[model samples]
Target: MPSAEAPAAAAMDGEQRLHPWSWLFVLLQQLRQFVLPLVALLVFGGGGGREAQWQALAAAIAMVVLVAVSLLQFFTYRYRVGADGVTIRSGWLQRNLREIPFNRIHNVTLHQSLLHRVFGVAEVRLESAGGNKPEAQMRVLGLAAAQALEDVIRHGGSDRAGRTPDAAEPADVPLLALDTADVLRLGFISNRGMIVVAVAFSALWQIFPERVASRWVEQHAQQLLGYATSMHLGVLSTVAAVGSLITFGLLLTRVLSMLLALTQFHGFRLHEQPQRLTVERGLLARLRTSVSRRRIQSWTLQEGWLQRCLRRRNLRIDTAVAETGNRSDARALKELAPIATPDACDALIQHLLPHAQWPMPAWSPLSASMRWRLLLPTVLVLLVLSVPAWLQAGPWGLCIWLWLPWAIYGAWQQTRRAGYAVDTALVAVRGGWWARYWRFAEIDKLQALRLSHSPLDRRCGTASLWLDTAGASNMQPPLRIRFMPEVQAQALYRQLSAALAARRLRW
Candidate 1:
């Protein structure tokens, strides 16, 4: 296979074609989208007598249509490198054509699934600066061709016209490497352990009856918590038993998280180039992506209560490009460090933004009066709940009132965590209570500025400021500061305004 970056020979056509195996990828994808319905119909056909034949025929027709569609897709799809941009043309009826210029290409992800690896083909997903969908997705390209295409999109490809592709350059440097041990560590701290349990439980239910496990868990819960025990159980003993169960559950989750992490980041590598950063990881569905430094909109560091206890942090980068339809882009690009020590996390920040230094944020803390506003909302909810409780059991109904003190403590903790600061390089915000988090973005990347004031805020002489940017997703934080002192909020707004006006926007 010829590299897409090289100048094509006169005998060879400039237009590129996918591997013959792309037809299989298309068929598998199409089948996946309709497998559930197909199975349901087949089951229904088995249950019914005369109607079974018609149902089976309908399912067969659906399968044939799906296969035909995939075949047509493979036949019609075409992609080629041009002087101005990379072009992708597809669709027989709608006839969709997409061309993405070099500057518009924000990021490129090269992925290979189990089948893709077997066929020596890759999926090249190109994400642009602005859009909901991906710029183009070349589902099956040769490994070398995909690499060359990604490189051509990133750097200037026009200069390589009428020439062969070059080998690895000296500018590339190995920045980070994650071993099996590191991946195992990442799994424990990932905080995403329920997926496995849920899938397993669902599969069990589908295979057997729901009561198979649910009843057993209920019976065990009764036995362990003293409901069915012969010995007398005091309140403290019951509480301790429940707490122990919770601790065991948390430990199980951590173990599961670690196992899942090992699967996702089995062989992770971070590479640094002159203008771009590349990441390669995974054992099953491999991911290889490059994100340009110029497209980075912001950086965020998060520490959950469990993570905080372990002195671990999750770091993510917010880029200008779209997220490629699903979280594959986020899973690959947003995560700068999935799991690392605080010092290692700080080092990653420095490595990513070498021009910027970590300055002490001069925070304007939220005022004490802000608690009154926070408490009011909770008070109304308590009042509404108390009405129903009073109707049921008079004096005992007010027991829900005990939750007030806990709620107040939570609100106070939030007040302590809430603050905003701005420095020469980044704007910072600290918020959240049990799971406190800090969000930071570069000062020059401000997209929009908004100052909001309520009647209470006006009376308290405070306001809220929102900092909008292009890089917003589930992975990154919303850059908004609530309940800031009016004078300080206005001052920061003015500074950010000046910063925005002075520099040209990137996205």
Candidate 2:
């Protein structure tokens, strides 16, 4: 039998079709993308039993067509990695061939779905600069084959340090590995549950037939009110009931969040080479992505109220080029450390970027004027709305006043969290109350810096600072330090300029 490395080298030079098992992957991919439309066609097709029968028949035909198409795609798609670069030939009707040169090839990502994992194959994606999509994607290949191809494309060899990937003596070292506890923290730290909820609600809305909108909402509201009224609830009882429901909803949402976290971050591991960081994660769909450490544009350290209470933080990395040149790829590549204790984060950052500070020192507050700027408007609006509410609902209207304090408290907390710091090598900013984040960009990656005061800020003699970089993490809002003392903003801007001028630009 040929040795593992030999086959890898040969595979790199030779054109090949996707692994046979890819048909299943292709089919699943199609079904997942179009399942909603198919569902809608059946649910709202509106022909009663006859229509249902026709819809079923149509769905069956569609499935057959999809299966056949997947088979054709698997057969037609061919890829090769060579000294020149990577080339792909796909499409059944009009041949669509793509060739990406090695230098132009931005990155190679390896992902494995549950189905692919079962078959011992992984997906390989090749990305190029300046696009929202990958240049080429191989839905299924043997895990070894994927790594081997990546090796040839990246290192110009079929093995690492003269050792085949299957060999045990590769030079790459493990940087970090999340244990069960750390993974659990990720579930709590993740705010993706809201996004999931929004998507689920969107699907549900699509599933609901159109004409039922007004009647359905009214009917459900009446039923809920009737049930609540039937209970003859007093203020305390109503409060308790509502509180219980709210708690349950929150718990359910958290549980959903936890599930997503587990599915996405299972068995997460990080490894480092001299020039790149490689991350491998997931249970259902495993993914391995590598990025050059130097390409990182910025770092974000985030802490929500829950994460803060738990003493945990999330670290995200922003890179110049999108990993696979798409949103999904961005999600997979940006998470530097999903959730870790502060100590672990410190270790990770020190190891990852030695010169960059994690929890910075000598932070300058955004200025106290921000407090009144945030609070005054809210107070005025509350007062404006409260009088009419009081007129209509009497005592119930006065109850709205209770929210004023909560709003003020939130605004105050934001002001407290707002700050900025500049060091010789980094420019950092802090904000966000419920979902607090600290973002710092390397002076080397600094693209542009601007300082502007809003009309409100002008009256208060405060300005907002915005810094631009090659790329910023989605989880981290754009670099905007709002409501800082105008002079401080200008000072930071100048400091950043000097620092940037002195350093070799990374981008």
**What would the TM-scores of all predictions be?**
0.87, 0.83
Per-residue lDDT for 331-360 in model 1, tens only? Answer: 447676777777887887787778777633
Candidate 2 residue lDDT tens string, 240-332: 999999989877877787888888888888778656787888867777887767667888888878888999888888777643343557434
Using alpha carbons, what is the TM-score of model 2?
0.83
Distance from true location, Cα of 163 in model 1, Å: 7.7
lDDT scores in order? 0.76, 0.76
Q: Which pairs of residues collide in model 1? A: 187-257, 187-258
Model 1 bad stretches (over 4 Å): 1-13, 43-46, 158-168, 199-249, 323-332, 359-361, 454-461, 473-476
